[model samples]
Target chain A: MGKLVYLYGIIPEGHDINELWDPEKSAIEGEDLPYVEDFGGLAAVVTKVSEDEFGETAMEENSNNTAWIQEKAFHHHEALLELQRHTTVLPMKFGTIFESVESLKQMIEEKEEHLQHTLQTLEGKEEWNVKAYINPKTFYERVAEANENVKAKREEIEQMSKGRQYLETKKLDKFIEEEMFKDQEKKAEEMYDRLAGYSEDSERKKNWKKDVTGREDEMALNSAFLVVSEDLESFLDQIREMEKEKEEDGWLIEATGPWPAYHFATMEE
Target chain B: MPIEQSTRSDSIVDVLELVLDKGVVIAGDIRVNIADVELLTIKIRLIVASVDKAKEIGMDWWESDPFLNSQAARKEVEDENRELKERLEKLENSMASDRTQIGEDNK
Candidate 1:
């Protein structure tokens, strides 16, 4: 069997690959160095891999291993990041392997138009991720203090008999929990709307469970925004404004940015 | 306004999810087998997007996943209820034991 080519991403035609640095002697180690396969005006940044290691069975086995996936995925991302510094890159998903370079070229040739359109749309723009988390305990306390209904329920519980008080308190806790969840969702939506105003495109990412996040605060909002290079400063300013406005409510905003347009690169179906 | 930048250096997890979720997929005739029985095939396509974006593109698996949806919250509440029931039972048992001991001492 012929060696497989691991495709990283596509870049526009005439991009000076050599100016970026020699792919043969890059610091992105532990894998084959990437090279460009030009198909007309577009080029695919790819690296060669032995079929034994990257074949179906081997890939399936490796997918189950977190360390292997992380290592390979990191290298793949590093290669794309490096290429992106020199030219706009349309990052491919990890493990996009072709049986051979000839087949890879043919595939690129077939998809050339769509690839060019995507690259043109994504040029000079980067993806920014903004995640908002709120300290649940403090947030609930603040909400309860601000809500009249919760205060009334608490007062009623205080006046009840011991048995009734215990049950009533439990009921109140459940009600509070439900209300807190609703409030969280509302806040997340509002934050997304505000941030979306500043972005060309925005996406609401799935909120990570507390255990998955490994954080004390609950994830209120997880989103990615596609911002133009010139609008990035304004986007950051908006985020800062939001932080000031929501800090009293125990909501925290975290942003990471100028990343490859991972969330905005979906090809039109 | 204090804005915090994400302190994560190893963004591999995100990248892994991204590459697997979004990107072009080109099928090829590559398969692994044992004794002429095909075991695996390399046909992968990924498109990573937010819930709304995925839905716009007709890919919304996360919405229906039980572990990632309201079912998980319900499970947590059920677990909490079970623990509370156990605690309530213990409290009632201890209260009964104390009353019986008091009656015996009075007699």
Candidate 2:
């Protein structure tokens, strides 16, 4: 069986691999950890795998198996994150492989300029993910108390005949749902805007469904911010403040990272 | 403000989604075959973004997916229920009119 190189990511020139990852502590089960390969000034962190397991057919089969994908993908991510702690890294997409180390080096040489630019731009920044969830029942209750339209509708329904009252109640429920969705969207926008002030760049992420998050609260905001290393603390502090301010509205904020500039490391043209 | 550092294990889902959805693709020939026939050709496409970062780079197929978009699925169910309710109302109205006509004929 032929051996292939499974590429993980690119690190800055002259970065020491041993300094980045401790083999004894960070080694993944059932997978070999990555080692750096110098290609001129840039280096690629890679691992060796048998062609039988990593070849097209085997990879296709494994991709379809959720369990296999999860295990392998997790290991792949861990290696990159480990490297990220030591130096700037341009993480490769999962499953990138080369026929030989020579070919991998050749590809790196060709893309050297683009790689250098990406590394330079992403050097001091880290990516942070902020997710905001709101308890729907509590949110609606607060809205009903504050909203004049809902208040007036409730009073109108109280004076109506029985049949009319039932129909009006249904209409009121629909109205409340519509208002709730609008309010959630508005709040998400406001939260994103406030956080954007602390970061070098920010992007609004697509809100996840309740099932994906496995949470009952509605996901009001999903966003990623590329913050400089110096601003990291202040950013976290502001998020805490926002959480406190919105607690009465049933808002919960979760922020994760100081991670590799995964969102900001696009290859320069 | 308390910031949570994403431990390697804690962000597996985020990492998986990122690596699959956004990353550089460097194509190479790594096909394996039998007896001069090509069986498999590997395409090396890598996505290196974290979950939310992937969304930033336009890797949001889950957003439009019916299974993942609970709100959209709920909307579809609501539409179907409305149609069924309208049909039931029509059936009840016709039945009531028939009874009225029968009473008038008897009188």
Candidate 3:
């Protein structure tokens, strides 16, 4: 048999544990409440899963099929959210399991000061995601219109550099790539400026090489805005208007939101 | 009531990142030992120039060979795994050689 996985999150002061979780539904709920530790600031939502059910072997076998991994991870993600409705929770990543309840308690004790500090920093803040995707066709057309010099150069190269067509094409491609990147950065900055007033701290999403979205160009800018809960509607409205303006020129601007502040939380190394 | 389709499937507010990145990083065993595997296997993400390119690649997979069948599929998976292992070994060896060279240079 395997050990239990303890969950950690922020919960309100004097929050009833029973109302937040049944614990009976956990895979190892019958064993114990797995020992809940108090930090005086927020309650840690802890639970355990059977070892055999989620061993390294399971991960190995499932890694080949991406769908299986997302399914399990998403389940864990939702479970964390179930705890969030009660309090402003700084959700842990999907696979944060510990060996024993005592070890988890020890970790909380060790990091209690830092954890409490993180929670305090995130008070009344919600995370919103803002993504900007380039509609290649529209963006390219805009680029052609914006850069007359490059366009004329391309024509000249096409007629004169027939022998070195590949080289000419390479030069033209480089010029186009640089301009596109510049515009993307400029647009992202403009959006950031518009939203900064509402956010405590904002961050760009990590650009890992993944094939989730149907775009090859590094997701132009994936940002997380930590906005005050009261400003949620206005923040969203601003995004809608910004998206419409960009959309007229073929930029796919999108925003999603009002979730627990995930990006604002940071570990003090 | 019929399920209402979401206009946008992916949400900007990634709750998982919040909890994982900002939440407490408890060093424990309830977590799987294979976190690296989790990163690699979470999706069959294929990056392409466009949606059409992605579809073409998807269709092309069927034309490649009989790798979809249970037997062939298992073999293909094993082959891919082995290739990754070999690539990792090669990278380590190169890194080791570079380190050794650096040590000599330090002398």
Instruction: Give per-residue CA lDDT, model 2, range A1-269, as digits (tens).
Output: 88788877888778777897767643333366667888877888878887777877776666644435545666666677778888888886667778899888887788789888888877888888888999999999888777677888899999999999999988987888788788888888998998999998888866755424546787889888988888888988889989989899889998978656656665436
* DockQ of each candidate, alpha-carbon based: 0.14, 0.17, 0.17
Where in model 1 is the C-alpha error above 4 Å?
A22-32, A148-169, B1-10, B22-107
Q: Candidate order by DockQ, highest to lowest?
A: 3, 2, 1
Identify the CAPRI category of the predicted complex in candidate 3.
incorrect
Candidate 3 overall Cα lDDT vs. reference? 0.54
Model 1: pairs clashing at backbone N, Cα or C within 3 Å:
B21-B46, B21-B47, B21-B48, B22-B46, B22-B47, B22-B48
Model 1, global lDDT: 0.64
Model 3: residues >4 Å from true position, as ranges? A22-36, A39-41, A54-68, A148-174, A208-210, A215-218, B1-107
Correct interface contacts retained, every candidate: 0.33, 0.41, 0.34
List the candidate 2 regions with Cα displacement exceeding 4 Å: A25-33, A148-166, A267-269, B8-11, B22-107
Task: Report every candidate's CA lDDT.
Answer: 0.64, 0.66, 0.54
Task: Assess every candidate by TM-score.
Answer: 0.70, 0.70, 0.66
Considering the two chains of model 2, state its CAPRI-style docking category.
incorrect
Candidate 2 lDDT, B1-107, residue by residue in tens: 43577652244345554556432233434532211000000000111112354456554433333122323333333433454455434433543577333223322
